[model samples]
Target: MSKVGIIGAGLSGLTLALALHQQSIPSIIYESRPDAPLNIGGAVMLSPNALRVLDRLGVYERIRTRGYTFTKVDYRNAVTDTVTEMQEFGGKDKYGYDALRIYRSELIDVLLEMLEAAGVSIKYGRKFAKVLEETERQVTWEFTDGSRETAQLLVGADGIHSTVRKYLYPDLVPKFTGLAGITAAVPTAQLQAPVDLHLPLTYVLPGKGGFVIAPQQVDGSEQLIGKQRRVEKDLTREEWAAFMADKESQVKFLQDIDPAFPEVVHRAVSNIPHDKINVWPFYVVPRLNAWSSEDQHRRVVILGDAAHAIPPSAGQGINQAFEDVYMLSLLLSDTAKENNKDYLAASLKWWQESRQARVDQVLELNKQIDLRRLPQSQDSDGLEKLNFEVGWLYDIDLDQVVGNWLKEFQ
Candidate 1:
């Protein structure tokens, strides 16, 4: 029997299966989508911390040639075209792996392949309905089809709107941050960019928000041009679908270029691929009282966006999720030994607290980056120029963490 039953076959769940398999722990994944794993939002960015986890799981080498790698993002003055600041997202020499931007489907396909090689099973078309029962030793849940399954532990990695989370907080809903990011893909040749312009940049339009141009694809032929704006009201699903379906409106929304930015900005918005348009409404799950059940069972667990849909400023959304599953898998192995039943609750508590601490750090990093984006003011907020450093974020050693924590109990 599968020791761990994972709900959702996205990055977190698939990666969790691999991590568990490495520790000789068996796991099964349940995905609602009948045909494929949950692969949306186009391409995703990965920093060093996540790269380390993927490398350890033997996923990085296979995907290395399928993505564009970079180390820094230049935040430039839109008018003068002068780089105002630089943020290092990754560095092989410093953090041991460069940042990667790859298509969501490509990564998911590779993960699925790896899971197959590892003999991990994934059940498609299985939607998690709700928790049927939970005890100190195991968990059982039902699907929307009325079928039931049980496992030694249940993990909810079901993105932002998670059904398993309902078992913990019945009324909880993801809080929209009142901002929506609209973007589209365009050929790099369309921009006709200057030779020295660095890629993956945030061109700060004078008073308006930043306009982003990030390169993607194996050859960097395509770039994602994006901008965000305040959204006062949250649209319904049908409304969102209609809004996105109108290609004319999406073009107009992205083409609202400011006069302060370079002519390249106007050129980048000249022709956006209709099929490549994407809109991401920012939503965050509030800091929860518990990521796991508070009772003695602690059988139902939630990670990734299910627990915290962190702000995207730091690009740690999926990266941090990788951290969660990997660390949890390692800890789960420790508890698998005989006579460790007494420490089950304590182990989970420590895991949640430890993961929460890193997530809190990432949030703080987001605030710092946002503050840095403000217009240079000699007076307001009294904010001094701060250099971006990510050693603490990327240089983490999860094995050391597991070992150190076990020592406390040993």
Candidate 2:
């Protein structure tokens, strides 16, 4: 059997590698980074839809113990300092799995451990350059290191700025969402707020900016993850530097919103070292006519952010990536009998068709959530509708969805 070549060691690529290993498919991952453990991202929320897939991969138990779990979210008005709404966000009873909050590094560590145990090879510092050639039998990838590798299939799980996506569809590009996300994590004990610390997650929406505060466990330490989103785009290096350097002004902005708001969020923001604060501009991938090469025989596919990147408002970015890996792995497993180019091509087409619609829905849902959280929208009904849509998203069962897709193939 020809080994699968995976690009990027991100959550999607690593999960796909593990899922394929479960089905006895041999594969290797080529990461552009130069090291095994890369700690470059902030906290992430894993909803039940994603947890269910991780559970199937046999790693959720380990992950569950390393993260904080929450079941409700408090939506408050930053200007009035009043709780507008409280919703049951996620729980096993509601969605058959718990919603977890953990640093992105911890999750990556768990994934790397699983891959190592499975004997999956990951070559670091192997930046993907472009497709060198594609034949009926195999597709070859050239890397920046002036090396090349050939495999039966190439899966691009890089990210929003994916070289693989550019190789497959050079014209498709990610569009800026006109929003920026600033995040930081601090010891929960540092917060001097009088509000109940044990309460559910909280979101304070004021003007055109929104703040999300949730408790998280990083390296066994209790920390609170504070995320702020505002309508800002294409910030230059100097502008970003200036923004980070003025911590006092940022704190004042929070304090001015609501006297109580700063107590809960300001401490976390101000206490974290300036270098530790993360500011990322949000971008979304335009809906593609197809997520894979038009010629099925080409055997090149894209998943996760490469396929469809969405805003973080819905917290479905990582969840949708897990779903992509699960579905693609299942379809590839079904092709094990034939184990040829034809079967591989057919499986890739099925995987793309099976996932594209759901991806479209999730992207649109994230957009709607962003709109409701905008400064102009203060209606409780909009918040309620956003909550309902989120619940609907987390309730989807990828296993059942794949089972139905298999029935059609049968």
Candidate 3:
């Protein structure tokens, strides 16, 4: 009961473990996979907010140069090819770190390496079945293998289909957002793009949607060319998995481009290797009344996608997960000495409310981006195009935020 038990060894869970270790809090990671976190996410774009967390946890330096780095995402007119709007992903001059597009595996490797050096243990192939019980001081859980374990705290960083989340919301399911990102990586040269062409560009055709061509890799040798699809009828989790596994169908989806789409898009999807494609269905977890149980014990908790899975509109899906891990660690460390249930409960309340505000902001940002990308978004109703001044998202001070909350409540 001296450490935390973390479910899911994915980015969020591993990062949480390291964040706890940095506070001298020992923990174990239980991953359902037989090996390292399933590296299926392809490459992820990390903005400054998430990078700051990694840098603080000693993960940035290891990966800063391993992937492509850029600062802006250009939304271009499909016909004129002129830029219509831009989203500031990150800026070394403004945010102290440029956005990074690194493979998920590379980042996970660094986290696992750090934890191993720190002597943290990871129980691979140990699937989390469900939370068995929660006491005032500790929580216990069972693995699919019938094994059980207890810890001072139990965290479900176990992603959108989280088994751990079932303990908190027995009937809750991740609602499909009617969209899915269909993507594939091809050599940057395949596009034969004009030299002046922006690296991360989205071309919008009013009625259809955006076609994205974004560079990846440290040398910018490859790019991810993708578009979103609307699924009228939501599929079960198993159905979605099967649909994603159908490489031929996924490739066909990407290739089903409008003739009016830019030539670059056509070329980009011309010869996608079946092995390099990814199908990411958008799913969102409804806002929960509590990230922790209503029971006074509140020993079991959830974070990352398990708590709130937002779409990748502002490319904050991973970035926001990083925030959750970092902020929770700060809050826990702030109240470690007292270990007062009242203080812990208050801190968690503050954490959820504050994080919810940020998530809400991201959702709004996604709406603005959606307006530009999707046809259905034409019914904007009242969504405002917030000035691109997103310093509030990328420029986060985790310690200061948690500290101020503590002082106010004290």
Candidate 4:
């Protein structure tokens, strides 16, 4: 049997494990966090591209049962309260999936449950501290506890501050955007009074770095939405709490942006303490010339945040990782059949070539989103073009991207 090892039990890591399992390929996952569910105070959108991958893993029905499918995407000017662009999501029944909005924890639970059913073992508290690749046949991992394990292939699905990334791209660091996201969920009743706009999975309010508000449905549970301010990353925890402490102040600030803003911001305030709100300093590893070695055949490779960490502005971070898994899984399957063997080296090479470009394109789009949030004076005609051209993002096709991999593999 070919042993595949995955580090990190996050969305990306778990998704990769599930994909491999569907292929009847066995793998093990090592998680640094204690064995417990993480409840981050935010929601995420799973585009049709991502939904297809989940469905193939047999988790889509479970996810849809838990989340709300959203068809329309609307963007508005935060200052003028004018709708800038609205578009219908393009990819659906073609692959039998649609965009969805769900809570972070709910998504985690669904993936974890599927992984468990696959008989994939996730060793929690076993942090990946170091790794060394000797040859195509052998790769070793050193955990924080001084324990070690060897595998035929090692994957670094660990998130942003990935120990694997550091080992590979030792000189590079994810650049901070200077923008911070303060996210929290609020009750629907609290929002209905001040703002009359029917919400979608996503809404953008234009301003200095602006705001985004969207609904998130927990797995088979209740629905909730989040409102967040895009601000500078320099604020301390104390500053963030103090700023949100006064509901009147938050309301007044929203009023300046748009009369309807208060309806959204106030709801966010009521759900969690001004203090419990999470302040995320967005960062990304910009266009990397490449993610593969000189020969393009190595026992190690990165997936998810470790490979292409990007800001959430476009909501592609998680979706992109799912795309990676779908594409790479197909490639590996093809390589196995062609060689009539494991063919780990050829699989890694083909996977890298197939995935790197798509990942780069998504990273660039995230940059465009960041540019759109810059001060009005900094905006240009190009930025205006981007606001109108984001339709592709909402309409990506994962199966198409996977292309030949499906034929050669499946």
Per-candidate Cα lDDT values, in order, are 0.87, 0.73, 0.87, 0.64
Q: Candidate 1 regions off by >4 Å?
A: 335-338, 373-385
Candidate 3 local lDDT, 1-410, one digit each (tens): 36899999989999999999998888999999998686876999999999998999989999998999999999988877789888899999999999999999888888889999989999899999988878888888899889999998899999998888888889998888788889899998899999999879999987778899999989999999898887887898799789988999888888998888778888898899988989888898998888887564777889999999998878888899999999999878764545566876777788888899999999888888888888566435466665677999999978788778878877
lDDT of 2 by residue, 162-260 (tens): 999887788776887665666655666676656554444455555545676676773424454545545556565598678766766554443443444
Which one wins on TM-score? Answer: 3
lDDT tens per residue, model 1, 1-410: 24989999999999999999998989899999996887678999999889988999999998988999999999998889899889999999999999999999999999989999999999999999999889877898999999999998899999899999999999998988777778899999999999888998999866566889999999999999998756788888898788778888878988998888899899999998899999888899999879888764888999999999987888899999999998998888874453566566778889899999999999878776666553432222555556788899999988888889888877
Candidates in descending lDDT order = 1, 3, 2, 4
Each prediction's number of clashing residue pairs: 0, 1, 0, 2
The TM-score between candidate 1 and the true structure equals 0.96
In terms of TM-score, how similar is model 2 to the real structure? 0.87
Give the lDDT of residue 277 in candidate 3.
Answer: 89
Point out the higher-scoring one by TM-score: 1 or 4: 1
Q: lDDT by residue for model 4 over 1-410, one digit each (tens)?
A: 26788888888888888888876778999888898644554667787767767777787888786766766556666545566666444236543466788767888898888888889999989888887554645578799899999986778888877887666777887777665555545555555533446455334544444455555554313334333454655455587566656545444343344444534544544444343345556677766544433243366778887888876756778888888877666655544354444455555556666567666676666556556544342423355445435445545555565565445644
Candidate 1: residue 112 lDDT (0-100) = 88
**How does each model score on TM-score?**
0.96, 0.87, 0.96, 0.81
